[model samples]
Target: MQDEDRRRYHDLRPDWAESYIRLERAASLIRTYEVQFVPGLLQTPDYARAVLSVVHDDPGEVERRVGLRIRRQALLDAPGGPRLWAVVDEAALRRMIGGRELGRAQLDHLVALAERPNVKVQVAPFHFDGHAAAGGPFTILRFPDRDAPDVVVLEQLSGALYLDKPSDVEQYRRVMDRLCTQVEPLDRTAAILRAIRAEL
Candidate 1:
């Protein structure tokens, strides 16, 4: 295979994609949980473009990044997407990044995603004391395959870190569980989204 082909294959490899893929796979097997922004797998393209546009200078590069995000979402529709459980901060829902229409669309998208059989959506209200996300947004992916390693993907301002170490992954898992417990349930989350849309 040519160098580019090799790279593409590597990117497409089933065992794992990157650190994120490993984490995502693990998330798929068991229950995966997210806190902060909507999980990448549930993000809408317009919301993604608006988020990416802030950091990327080149329009082409921005589009590529957006495309990558959309592709990442495919895992949600795959034969067995993980049992996706996401706790989104109220601030994230209120932030008007892509204008009212796009923001409304994103919220609508979230409502739809929450309806999926294997998916759960929760909302962490800003008024709650324990609602702050530690180290920003992070996901703890647990795999049904006991042999597969649990993974955590932490997003940062400069880049992202993928953690597979038992200790670190365990810590993130606890954090995710705590956040989920504190948030409103799926139906309430959808209601919150509706209220946000009404205001927009």
Candidate 2:
């Protein structure tokens, strides 16, 4: 990958820098949760543009970030790429972070990506009561190399936390497992996405 294809954050936080390396190098699986917006990997170009526009006022920076995001997504399609599973709260789908048209496009994009053999997308609906992941969004990355322990990434306003401690990884794994059970089944996600798109 080219140097510019790497993940780029405005703040250049050290945690994000390290996290990016792990993300690109991990060889087994990538699982993520989103409570407020579409997962970065799954966001459409237009939706990404909209989302980036909010945090960055500079057009050049916004465009650069969008390109980086899109490049990261290519990892999913690469040969022997990690299996990607994402669980998103239904509220994340409903929030109009990028306005109605772009939001709808984003949902449509999600529906399309869910069809890929290596990707799984599930939605935690509003009616689903008592969730295990009340602490907001996080990601679990498992590497093919046995020496590399599984890592749980917790993103905060200041930066990100990469937790590799066995206990911490196990706890987040349980939370993710519960979230999978609480969400709509994979078979039905496309239908729900289409319905949401129509409403938007």
Candidate 3:
């Protein structure tokens, strides 16, 4: 295997760098539930910069991280790689992270990406009367290998937690299932996204 084939498991600071590398390597089907900003894989460059600058002050470092984020997303387009099924809260769509124009571009990006057969975008509306994913944002990574099992990633204020045990992973799986069911259907999500963009 080449260098990129290897999975590194640690990185600097409060970031879950190594876990993200594992995500890039092992995830054959990536399911994410985000209640905040857009998932890194789906974020526009400006949106990514806005999210990154919230923690880092240096423009140089922020750009470097943005490049890394954009690179990670390349996996979604790689041949025979993972297919992303992301359920984003409606709040994330309406947040206007970078600004109104950037927000509109982000919505346009999401709508365009959802057109891909492998990419599934579902919107979790506020009217669900509370749901299983109320805990917070997380990613459940499923690998192609049968023995690998699913890995659940939870980002915190300082660092991140990577849960690999069957019980923990199963719990997150259940939350993901409930989220998928509760969110608007794909077509409805597309319409909602367009509507949100218009408002922006």
Mind giving the per-residue lDDT tens digits that candidate 1 earns over 1-200?
23564354453343333555545644654444444355667889888888888777888777766767776677777786677777777888888887999989999998888888887888887778775354567666677778878867665665576788999877777777777777776668778888888999
Off by over 4 Å in 1: 1-17, 25-36, 132-135
Q: Which regions of candidate 2 are displaced past 4 Å?
A: 4-15
Model 1, residue 191: what's the lDDT? 83
Task: For model 2, name the residue pairs that clash.
Answer: none
Error of 1 at 77 (Å): 1.0
Q: Which pairs clash inside model 1?
A: 26-142, 28-82
Candidate 2 worst ten-residue window by lDDT: 4-13
Compose the digit string of candidate 2's lDDT tens values, residues 30-143. 899999888888999998898888888999878877877787788888899888899998998998986898888889889889999999999988987768998889999998
RMSD of each: 4.1, 2.2, 2.8
Output the worst ten-in-a-row residue range by lDDT, candidate 1.
8-17
Q: Give the CA lDDT, 0 to 100, for residue 68 in model 2.
A: 70
* TM-score quality measure for candidate 1: 0.82
Clashes of 3: 0
